[model samples]
Target: MTIAEHRTDTTHPLDPMTTAEVDAVREVLTRDGLLGEHVRFAYLGLREPGKRAVETFTGRADLDRRFLAILLDLGTGASRSVIVSTTRNTIDSTVDIDPATEGQPPIIDTEFELIEDILNADERWTAALAKRGLDPATVRAVPLSAGHYDEPGESGKRIVRSLGFQQFHEKDLPWAHPVDGLVAYVDLTGRRVTRIIDHHEYPVPQEQGNFDDPAFTGPARTTLKPIEISQPEGPSFTVEGSVVRWENWRLRLGFNEREGLTLHQLSFHDRPLLYRASIAEMVVPYADPSPVRFWQNYFDCGEYMFARYANSLELGCDCLGEIHYLDATVADDLGQPRTIRNAICMHEEDYGVLWKHTDLFSGTRETRRQRRLVISFFTTIGNYDYGFYWYLYLDGTIQLETKATGVTFTSAYPGADGAGFDYATEVAPGLGAPLHQHLFCARLDMTVDGDRNAVDEVEPERVPVGPGNPHGNAFRSRRIRLTSESVAGRLADNRAGRTWHILNPDKHNRFGQPVSYVLSPEGQPPLLADESSSIHARATFATKHLWVTRYAEEERYPAGDLVNQNPGGAGLPAWIAADRDIDGEDIVLWHSFGLTHVPRPEDWPVMPVDRAGFTLRPFGFFDRNPTLDVPSGGNGGHCAD
Candidate 1:
C-alpha cells in the first residue's frame, strides 16, 4: 500500500489523470460509501510519484497512480481529504477538515449557482437592490471567496461573499454597471444568506463596455497587411503522448485541475536541469480600502481552481504556425470526468538572433537566428484572462512570460464631474478601475546536474573609488551562499542587478566552476499590502521576491492546500519555520514576480496584453556558447522599396 499501484495504460509516472481514470476514482469512492448526497469533489488529481520513482521510471507498468481528492459536504459544512487507489479498489486514507481551524476546501463549480439561488430568493437582497433603483432580475450576482477576518458567525462557515452588477439585457456587459456598496454573505452549507452589508450607494456607470460589438468598435482598419507564418517542412519538434522533444530539450507536460500547465523531467541534451516547474499560486489583491472592497483578495489557483477554466485554444488566434495541441481532463463537482480539448498549445517561434558578429579585419559576417519551443495555455478567471507561456530556447535559456488581458474589473465611481477615488482610476465617466497587483509564484524544483543543489544570492555592486579602484567606474559581483531557509528569503533589487544561481557544488564545467543556471528577475514590487492586512498573512509567499527551501514532496503549493477559507500564516511562511539547512541538498526555488497594474484609459472596453515574468539562463552550466553549432539560416523574405 505504500507504493501507488501502477497501470499498464499510463506512459509516464507524472502523466495526469485521464477521463477514464477519473471515472474509476468516482466509482471507487462511491462503492466505499465515502461519497454522500451533498458531498462534492472540490479537488481531484493524480498523486505525484516520489522523486526516486520518477528518476528510476523506465516506461514500465510499475508506477504510482494514486489519486488525491478533496471532498466537501455542503449540507454539513464538513470537508475531507481522501486518497483512493483505483487499482486496489479501496480507500487509502481520509482526513476530516475542521473549517474553524484547518480551513475549508476549494469552492466548487456547483457552489457558484447555489450562491446565486440563495441570494436571488432572499427578500433582503432584493430590497437592497430596490433601494438602489434596480430590479432584482437585472442584477448578475458573482460569488466571491469570503476571506477570513474572524468575524462573528462567519469564523468557521463555508461562506461566499457576492457582489451584484446590473445588466439591462442578457448580453449587456455586467462589469460596467457594478451594484456598488452592497455585499451579500451567503453560507453555502446553510443554503441561506448569513448577512448583507449595505453602505452608501454609488451611481452605476452607464457606458457600454462591449468592445467586441460592431457598433462599439466601428469599422475595421484595412491598412495593415497580413503576415503569415508557416512551416512548410513541419515543426522541428516532436510529441509522443505527454513527452515532448525539440532539438536538445526534452520534457514532459502535466496538467491538473489546480495548476494548469506543468513541466516535469526537463532536460537539455539528456542532462537533467529541472525536475519540475509550474506556477504554484497566484493572488490578485485590490488596493481600494472602501467598505465593500476592503477585503478584496483572490487566490486564483488555490481557491477557484485556476486550470478548470482553461480556454480551448484556436488556430491563427491563440496559436500560429505549425502547432500541436494537448487535451486535459479533470473531474467536475459531481466527480464526473470532463475534458478540455486543445487546452495546451505547443509550437516554435523564431527570435531575432542567437549570436551575431562582424569581423572588420576579414570583412566577414556571422549570425545565427534564435528559435524557442513554446508551451503555453490560457485561463480566463472571472474578468481577467491570463496566458502562461514557457519558452525553451536553443541557447539553453528558459523563460516564462505571463500575459494578462481582458476587461478591467470595474466599480462605480463615487464622485461626479469625472473625478475618481484615490485608490481607483476613472477609466470611463463614472467607472472606476481599482488599482491591483497580480503576484505569481513559480515553483522550480531544481536538478541542475542531479538533485543536490545550492543557491547563491548574486548582486552586482559598484566598487568604492578609494579602495578597490582608483576610478569610480569599477564594479564587481557579490555572491553569497544561501545555506539555510531562514536567510534565503530575499528581495529583488533592480538597481543592484540581483539574481540567484542554482548550482551543483559537486559538478563543475570545463572552467572548474560549478555548473549552474541563474534566475534573472524582471524586478517588480512584491506584495504591496500592509503587513497588518489579513491578505499579507495569508499570501506571505508574495511578500518576498525569492524563497529557497529544501525539496519536500508535500511542498507543492506556496499557499496551503485548503486555501479557500484559510486564515493566515500557512504555506511558505509555515514551512520555513523549521530553518532547515539547504546547502548542497536538493532544493526548490520559489520566485515571485508580477505587475502592479494602474489601469489607463486605453485599458477600458478590452485590455491589450500586459506581460510579466522571469528568465532562467545558463551561467556556468556550459563551458562556452552552447548554440555555436546552431546552423545559419534565413527565410529569405527580403523586401524592396
Candidate 2:
C-alpha cells in the first residue's frame, strides 16, 4: 500500500490536520504578521473540537477547522498561543504567554542544534572538555531540560542544561562514555552560556556499547526457523481515513505533535465506552542525587514532545500480517508540515481462546478462538524507544500496553566494583545506569452509555467471622462513589484488588446494576520522589494512581499545558482545587502506571523490551458474554506444525 498524503476532504471533526490544512495554518499566521526571524514555532497541532461539536458532527462542510500554534519569541523569552481558523484564513484569538510566570513553552527541534553550537563556541566549555583530556570534536554535547529548582539565576529564563559525552569515533555510542561532574546552563533566549559548573572530574568509561552490528557479534545464528504469519484474506479490520472498524469495535485515530496517537469515539456494538483516550503525559525521573545530576527529571511527552520524533514504521519489522499503515502530518519549527510515513500501524492478532465449554453429560464441546485489533505507534526519544499499543478484544476488553526498549542512559562509575552509589546499578564494566521511573499518565474521557456517568472505587475486602460469615472465608467487594474532585484522587491497593468503575447513572444491566466498564490497573507505586523535592510538586499527577474530575475542554493535559521548566502544582494538582462535582456528570479519568528501572548487566549495549499498561473490562455493561457469537475454528494447517 502506498503512503497517504494530505486530505482535501475533512470527514470527521476529530480527524487530524492534513498537510494542506497545516499549510493553510501557516498562511494565516504569515498574513497576520506573526512570522519573523525572532519568532519560532514551538508546537502546532489541530485544536480539538468541543465535545458538543464532535457529537453533533454529521460530515458537514461548514465544520470549523482550527489550528493551535504555539510561537516562541527567542529574543524576549516569551510565547504566544495563537488559534488560527483555516476556514476564515484568520487568527481567531491569541494569548500572550510570559515565561517568567506562565512557564516556558516546549523547545523546538532547531534549539537542540543551537545548544550544540553554543557549547562548541564557548571558550569555557571547551576548556572544561580539554581539562578532561577530551577534544571538542570527539564529544557530543546535548541539551536537557533545566528543571525548576528556584536557583539563583534560573528563575525567569529559557535555560537548558548541557552535558557532553566522549564520542572517541563517529560510530561509537556517546552514552557509553560520560564526562561527569561538568555542567553548563545555557540561556536560549540570550543565546549564551549563563554558567558552567564543573565539580571533581571522573574518568570516562572506555567500553564500546555497540551490539547491533554484524562485526560486534561475529556470526549470526542459523538454528531458528522462520515463523511467518499470513492472513490469506487480508486483515479483518476496515479503515476509512482515520476511522477504523473491526468486528463490533469502532474508533477514530488522531495524531499530533504532543500526544502521538489518540483514540476517539471508542465503541463496542455501537455503545459508547470511551469518548476519547490518549497517553496524556509521562515523566522519567532519575533517582541520583548527585550535585550535577540532581534535577534530572524529564517530562518526555510534555517537555520534549517525544511524539514529534515518531518512528516511520516498516512492515515485518515494527508490525506483521496484512498490516495497514496511516501516515501522520505534524509541523516543523518553521511552521511547515512534515509527514511521517507509516506512523500508525493497524492489524489483528489471534489470542488463544475467547470462550470454551464442555458438557460431560452430553459429550459435547464448544470453543471459540479470540482475536483483537491492534493500533500502535513507536517513538524514539534520545536513547529510549517506546511503543504505545492499544488493543481491542472481541470480548469488550480494551488495553493499552507500553513497550520500552533502547540503550540505557549511562553515567560514570566511581568505583571499579560499582559500590557506594546507592541510586545506580552498573550495567557495564564502568557504566552506571541510574535508577529511574517511567511514570505514564493516560487520559480517559468516558461515556459509558451516555454522558451522565459516575466513578466508583471498588475494592475486595476480607470478611470477618460473624453471623453473616460464620465460615470465616467469605469476602465481598465494596464500592464507593467518588462524588467530588477533592476525594477522587486515589491510590491502588493490590492486597484489596482495587479497581475503578465508570458507569452511567441512568443506565443499568439486566441484573439492575449500573452499566459500567472497570479499569484494571497494574498497581505500580506512584512517584517515589519525596514531598519536599521539586519533582514531587511538578509531577503531582503521578503521585496518585487514579484521579477523577469533571470533564472540561481545557483540562486535557495532566501535567498542565506548559511543562518545560514550570514549577509544581499546575496540571492535575492545580485543577482539582475547584473540587467540582464529578458523580453523575460528565467526568474524565486519569490513570498513572509505569516501571521503576534498576538496570542489570544484561541491559547494557541495548536493552530488551519492557512492558507496562492497564486494561478496561466490561463489568455490568453487558448482560451476557459479549463474544458468545464469535466464530469457533482453528487454522487448518496448524496440525502439521
Candidate 3:
C-alpha cells in the first residue's frame, strides 16, 4: 500500500510500499488468518514510531526505522484498526494491532471507480431506467458524483451517489447536460438503490436535441496564422532526479496525494528562498441558494482531493516546447501503486519582452531576450479543469497562476421564466444555471533566507492635506508589521494598496531594505456563502484575501484532513485562533484567489480558460536589477538609440 505525508515533515513515517512489499505484507497478514472476508486495504504506508530529539531528517537519516502501517476495513460488524508490521523482521511481529481499537469509518472513502462500477452493476439501475421509460441505447444513466453525509448525529461511513441521464446526441461537441435535478440515492454497501429523487423530469425540459442545435453552435469562420513557441536551442534547464536546476532557479519537485505538484527547497542563485510551497486548499461552493445547488458546496482540494485526480498529461494538448516531465507515485483506492506520468511539465516560454531601453538622443535601443520557465499541470473535476502554473522568470520573480477551463456545469431549464437570468445565462435553449465561484488558497511556506521570518503589509494612501500637503493628490506609504496571526487576515485593496509580504529580518539587500517577496492578489472574489453555512465553517480560509500564520507540521492543510466529510474546517482558522506570536517565526502565507463567473453565451460547449491567481515578486529580495547582466542586443534589428 502507498503512504503519503503532506508538507515538510521529516519524521513522518508514511512511506508507500512497492508491489513486492505489499505482497510480502499480504502474505504475512493472510498467513496470520487476520484477513477477514472484506480484506480491503484502507491505507498502507510507513509511520514514524516515536518522538525524536531532532525533527529534521539530515545527516541522522540512518536512525530512521521503517515500520509498515496498514489500515484495513474488514467484513461487516468488524472493527477497523491499524496493523503495524516491521518489514525488517516479518517473524518477529505478524500483526501488532491494539485489540481495543475499532475501525473508525472514514468520513467518505467511496472511490469514483468503485462507485461507478457498483452502480452500473446493480439490477435496480436497470429497473430505474425502465421506470423512466428510457431506452438503454439512446439514453444512458451517468454517475455525476458521490459524497458522504457529514451532518451532526450522522454516524458510520455512508456514501450516496448522484446520477443523471443524458441523451446520446451526435452533436460532435461536448453535449453533457444534466437531467433536471433528477438524483438517485443509493445504499452502496447494501447493493441497492433505496430511493430515486427524480422530479418526473421530461425531455422537453432538457435540451437533448438542442445539443446539436445551431443556436448553441455559433457560426465559426475564424482562421489565424499559427504562432508557435519553439525552443531552438533545446531547453535552458536541467533535471537530475526530482531536483531541477534552471538559469537561476533550483528546486526539488514533489507530488503528493493531497497537493499535486509542489516545489520544495526552492532556491535562486544558490540561495534558499522558500523551504516548501504548495496550494494549501481550495473550495468551489455555488451560490444558487436552492436546496440542490446551495448544498452543493465543494471543498475541491480538501474534499475531492485534486492530487489524486491529476491527469498523466498529453504531449501537445498539455504543454509544448523542449518539455521535461516529472513522474509521481500515487496510491489507488485499492492501495496500489498508480504511476502518474508527467505529472509536472517543465519548459520555457517567450513571455514577450523582458526589458527594453532606448536612448532617443542617439537613436539607440537595447533589448534583452524574454523567456520564462513554466512549471505547470492540469487537474480535472467533474466538468471543469484547473491548470496550476508556476512561472519562473530570470528577474528573480515567481508568478503563480491558475487557469480554469472545460465544460461549464450546465443545469436543466424548463425555459427561463426570466428568474435565473440575473445569476445564469442560457447558453442553449433550455439549459440555464447560475454562475458560481471557485476559491483557491495557496499555502506558501516562506523560508526567506531562514526560518525566522517577519510578515508585514505596505499600503499607499493619499495625503489628506493640511500643512503637510496643499494638494490632496500626494500619497504616503503606510507600513505595518504583523505581530500576530490574528492581525494577519486581510483583504486586498487596489486603491489603498492592500498588499502583504513576508520578509527576512536578518537578511537585507545592498539597499539596506529587508529581503522579502511581495504578494499581489489578482482577480479575487468576495465570499458569497453565509457565515452560518457549514461550508463557511470549513472554508474560513477563503473569507479573507490573505492570511499569515506560523509554520506548524500539523497545520499543512488550510482545510483539515477529513475534507470529504468535514463541515467545520479544522486547520488554519483553528490555528489562527491560537493567536500565536508570529512576529519572527517560520511564516506561512495563505493567499486566496478566485473567479466570480456569471455564465455568458460564449461559456457554452466549453468555457475559455479564465485565469486567476497572484504573483510573488521579489521586493527587496535582491539588490538592484537581478537581470542586470541580461544581454542588451536587439532581435537582429537596428538599435533605437
Candidate 4:
C-alpha cells in the first residue's frame, strides 16, 4: 500500500490510519494470539511503521505493510512492540522493553487522560494536593511541568516519572508562577502516588495576577481593519491528493506521527531533486546547571514527538493567502485513531523582491517581483510554540525556517544566591525563566537527478600573485569531493567563506557546471554543548553543520529513535562508526541549524515569534537567472483599489 493508502480519508495517502485500520490490526493480533490473556492491550497505534533500513525507494515492492502496535503487559510489567502484517493476517514479530518503567509514573501535567482525571474527579488527586498543604481551589492552573526520567534520585528501585509543579494564582494564566517549589512523583507502572515534594511550605501565592496583562501590554496593541489577501486568479500551486504541483516543482506532502511533515519525491523542472526531506530530529537542551535543569534537557522531536502536538491553526493568525489546511491522524494514548485538524497550512506569500536593478549606466532599470509557497506546521510543546516552514521559491531555491514563540519555561527561584544561573528576569513576582538552547536538525535526502550523489565542499580563497604576475585582486575557488562517509560530514565555517553542495556528477547545466544545490548557513552555529555532554553525544548529527552518510532509513533520527532517558548511544555517531562508502552512492545529508535563546523581559508572558533557519539555493542547477522574466509591476497594496 502507498503512504496515502489505508488512511480512512483516501483523499491523501499520508493521512492518519483510519479507526478501521486500527481495529483490523487488533483483530489480526488477536487471531494470531499476539495479545496475551494477562497482558493488557493498553495502546495500539500506527507506526508509519517502517521504510527500508536503506533506500527502499529503489525497490518499492520491498515495502512492508504492517500494523505497529504497542502494549502494556501487566502480567510481566513490561512494554511490548508488536508488528502484525496486515497483508498476511499474521504476527510478524513481538518485542518487549521498558520493564523498569512498567510501573513507573506518567508525565502528569501533559498526560491529557491523567489531567482530565485530576480536573474532574473529586478524589483521584485531592489527597496528593492536600499532602503538600495545598487546597484544590488554590490551584489556578496545573500543567505537566516535568523533565527527563532519571534512574537515580527519588525514583530509587522503582521506575518512576517525576514532575515539579508550577502553579499560577489567576484561574487562566497557569504559567504565571505565583506558587513555587512543589513536585509530584507517581508510579504509573502500579498507578499509585509516590510522593509530593513541597520544601518551601507556604500558602499558594494569591496575588491574582495576569502576566498577559492588557493594561501595559506591548505598546498598546492596535487592531487594524481586516485586510484580505486573495489570489483572484486562483493559487499558482495545486494539490492533487498528496501530490502538490507548482511552478517547476512537483512532490508529495506526507506526514507521520513520528515525523510531522515530509516532502517526498520532490523534483524541480521535472528533474528528480530529492526522494525525501524532513526534520529528522530536534534537540532543545536547556543550559541551567541545576540538578533538575541538568538532566532536564530533551530531544524535542524524539522524546516528545513534536509532530503529535501540531496545532489546529487559525486563518489570519497563522497564515494569509489562499491557505489549504492538511489534517494528520495518529493513535491516541489509548491507541485510538485521533485526527489533528489543520495541522499543516499551505499558502503563498509575497517575498519583497526576487531581483531588481536601478541602473545609472543607462536610464533603464528592471525589477523582478517574487512570491513563495510555504508548507508550514506549528506545534506547541509545553509553553513554547515552534513553527516549521519550508519555502518553495521562484528562483529554484528552497528555504527551511523555524519560528519560536509562546511563553517561556520558567523556574521558581532558589531562596538565595541567584548569581550565576540563567536567572533572566522576574517574569512573575518570585519566578525566573532561565535561558536555554533550541537545537534543530533537518535531514535532506538529496536525490539530485538520482540517488547517487556526492558532497562537494567549496571555500573562497585569495589567489597568490604568481601566474604571469597576476594582480592580487584575483580570488580563488577551492573544491573537494568527499571520498568516504567518515570524512564527508563537516561543520560550517563562515570565516572561511565555506559552502557545501550536494552534487550530481552525471548531470550538468549548459554552462558545464554540476547540477547541484548548496547548503548555505544563515548564521554562526551554537556550541555551548559539546561531545562530552550526553545530550550532544546522542545527537552527533549536530556535531557539524552538515553530515553526509549513505542512505539508511533506520538512521532517520540523528539522535536515535528512543531518546527519552537514553544517553548518548545508537544514533548518527554509531552509524558513522561503520564508516560506510559515501562517494557516488545514495547519500543522506543531515543539516543542523540552531539559535541560543537568552530570553529577556519582553519574552516573559509569551516570547515573540522570532525566526531563524537555513536555505538551499540552486547553485549550478540552472544556467542563468530563473526569475529574469518575472513581471516588475503589479501595484499591489493592502487591498485591491
lDDT ranking from best to worst? 1, 2, 4, 3
Is candidate 1 or 4 superior in lDDT? 1
lDDT of 2: 0.88
How would you encode candidate 3's per-residue C-alpha lDDT over 1-641 as one tens digit per residue?
23222122222232333344445455555555556555555444433333222225555354343433334343342233344443442433434332222112231244344454565565655555557665444434443323333433224433454555455555523245555545555544454455555554534234443434667656654695665766666787997766788888998776665677787778898877777778878887766554344456666665555666688887777987678887666554455556778878888887767788789799867678767889988888777899999988888788888999987776665444665545556777777656788888888878878778987888887788788788777887789999998998888887676777778888888888888988888736657778877677767888898888877765777866455445464677788998988888877888888888887878776788998888888888887788867665423344356
Cα lDDT of model 4 by residue, 509-590, tens digit: 9988778888898645654675677666555666678878887755777876555445455578778888998877889888
lDDT of 2 by residue, 1-641 (tens): 22223345776778888989988887778777887887888999899888987888777674888889999887787789999987667789999987766688997787888887899889999999889889888888878998898778888789999888888787788999988888899999888998888986888889888776677656889998987899997877899988899989889999987999999999999999999999999999999888888989999988988999999999988998889999999988888889999999998898887777899799867777888889999999998999999999988999999999998888877665424578888876667899999999999999998988999999988999999999899988898999999999999989889999989989988889899999999998899999999999889999999999898998988989999888878889888999999989999999999999988888888999999999999998999988766655644332121
Using lDDT as the measure, which candidate wins?
A: 1
lDDT of 2 at 538: 86
Q: Write the residue-wise lDDT of candidate 1 on 123-194 in tens digits.
A: 999998888889888889989998888678987888888999889897789998998889988888899998
The lowest-lDDT stretch of 10 consecutive residues in candidate 3 is: 98-107
Higher-scoring candidate on TM-score, 1 or 3? 1
* Candidate 2 segments exceeding 4 Å error: 1-7, 417-420, 634-641
Report clash pairs, candidate 1: none
